[model samples]
Target: MVNLVVTLRKKSQGIWRSSFVRSVAVVASGTAGAQAVTIAFAPLITRLYGPEAYGVQGAFISIMSVAAPIGALAYPISVVLPRRDEEALGLLRLSAYISFFIAALIAVGLWLGGEAVISLLEIESISTLIYLLPVAVLFAAWKQMAERWLIRKKAFGVIARSALANSGFLNSARALAGFVYPSGAVLIVLATVAEVLHALLMLIGIRKRTTIDLSESSEVSTSNVIELAHRHRDFPLYRAPQNTINAASKSLPVLMLATFFGPSTAGFYMLSQMVMGMPSTLVGKAVSDVFYPRITEAAHNGENLSRHILRATGSLAAIGIVPFAIVIFFGPWMFSLVFGEEWSMAGEYARWLALFFFFNFINKPSNAAVPVLGIQRGLLFYEILSTGGKVVGFLLGFYWLNSDIWAVAIFSVVGVIAYSGVMLWVYLCAVRWDRDKKAV
Candidate 1:
């Protein structure tokens, strides 16, 4: 009996190790490909679009950000932990339908609320918001859901290739539009169209890979969705609050900058975010793409889930933090040189935000592990406190002192650190609980 147990343990360990390798290979390749396409286009986008265009894009990005969770309606979380083929397809269809409906509503809302959105962003015109519907928000949501679905299916190659193709199309369209239209307004419109084109391509790629047959199976009903929601009830229950806090915390400062500092200063800040976000988002997202699915698979046994989570946290931290430090030191000058002299101030903003991004990079993957381990309530509590802290910081910076740009910068750095600290504590506590439970 002892000999048999030893052999079984060895086999289990080997299987886990293999799964780790496969997960890393797939996620890394996809993330690296995405980073490549986005990074390669950075110079051209900056040169052609300019800072004001970037500021507008950033504002639009904030509004469109709501589209993802709204359209997905918790489907990303569902995809990460589907227990059966039927469950996976059900969630997939529900997510698509939810996304389409929400996108249409949002597009129409944007059309009606164009003036309000433009005024809120402090831009001079609503023209950009008017066209933001079909080209930008809807397509952007489609692309995100498609990407999440691809991750669920473990189709990394499809993701990589589509990212490249999408980037190529977007840049090419922007270039042509700039040459012919000359107005920034037209270029923004064209970019939205490009995003739709990108989504269409990803959809084609997804269809080829997954065997999702809705016709043969019984239709997923309202009760089915509600049941699915109840099945993974912890997702939006825990994730939604955390996501809302994090999203609001991140966006609030940018919104304040736009409100007080004007679009040009906001433009500079936007550039900084775009630069620092690449690494943070890339590493965190890649690890998450693997971590959620794997941890979910292992969750029935606490010991297995804990080991996987810790292993992932370590790998993600090591890879994510080192480059973050290097970027912090060299980031300002790199920004100036890369983005041109007009964007020199962006370098200053970059330096501060880099620290925030680094902390975020270090902590985000670990936070992602919580939901998979069934400890999302802890994360929710942390985000609640962190969001309160962020709001206080924002008020102190913007309202009390009336320091515009610097206030925004300081708030970002401090808010991220505070948020990361809480997240770390929660993750560690969850890890300890798993260990103790395993001992029992």
Candidate 2:
């Protein structure tokens, strides 16, 4: 009895000091667990699939990427901004309905239009993986929604478990597919199934807690749903473009590389992103999941969300910078050693892209605070400008001018600096407005 009380006290104390930290830990642990499983199976995957297989997988993921911005329909932000539990619940249900309908449409479209998409992307040469696109998109959308729900509830533990299970199973399945199928397309399909199953498990895990029993509670009214969607219209209207531009800008480089060069060259660029960007993507997401809701609440209360934002940024930078730096410095050797000589060029790409990863770690979460202040429109405009800059840079580097790898590297740096500047400027403007309003 004494020991149990002591244990509970420690847990409570930790939560009191930093609820966000606890939340991040739950998601991080799950992510780490998932990555651990993948890393353990990495050698097998590398040996079996090769860089060309990875290239095909990247194409599949890239095509399916639309599932996020479209299926979400800006509903994820609704989870953070609403003031009342009822309002939030209404938003949740409405968003889920919209998301499900969109998911179905997207799945069907991807299934039917896989050929056209492949041909458009000039990936018809490797059309064997075309059929896997829709199935993967469906599961990806499902997992994305489920993860958002968990993030909304601060159900960090559930998130961690689901992510771990999903990552482990998906990677392990990929390994098995590699051994048995050898066709990169088949391996990609199996990987998608594993991911879908993982996401479903997470949905099941959270449904018990998140579901409102109509029998025990007030009935959900049609008016409530309409009002919920209407109230949160800012999300799809303003926030969605910001997210879309950001994703588009990030995605443009690889697509350009693939178009200008080929899958083999694109694979080299992607391998770098996969390794160096992992920490930024995972850590930034975990921190954003915790900070966005809390900071939004703080903003609503006229509290200084700036300090919290800085603290979150600082924490991520501190932890992520070292790993990022190591990769930047040693990426070439690491790629060669880990993935074999064929992938040695992957290191150069990693070294080049690591700069983006570093800035992205700072840029991503800091950018989230903008939406909390309800400036998603302004954010969208800024992302559009920045994205345009990135597109120009990619074209100059990858196509219209220089196709040399070193020129691509130099242009990428210029693009990162330009985009990073825009991100920081926006963050400053948002913070200033937030502070002024809080003072008023």
Q: Report every candidate's CA lDDT.
A: 0.68, 0.70
The sequence of per-residue lDDT tens digits that candidate 2 reaches over residues 1-440 is 99999999998897667867778777777777776777678667777877766766666666666445766577756765666556666666676677678767766776777678786566774686665655665555566666666666777788778778778677866777677876657655776677679768877877665654434214557787887778778778877767766776666656666666777776777677777767755777777777777777777778766677667777777887788788778988998888778888888888777777787877656776877766677777777777777776766665555664654576468657865776666567667877688678
For model 1, residues 348-403, the per-residue Cα lDDT tens digits are: 77777777887776665567666665667877787777777767776787778887
lDDT of 1: 0.68
Report RMSD (Å) for each prediction in the order shown: 5.3, 4.8
Clashing residue pairs, candidate 1?
A: none
What ranges in model 2 sit over 4 Å off?
Answer: 1-17, 104-114, 125-132, 208-218, 404-411
lDDT of 1 at 340: 79
Candidate 1, residue 54: lDDT = 70
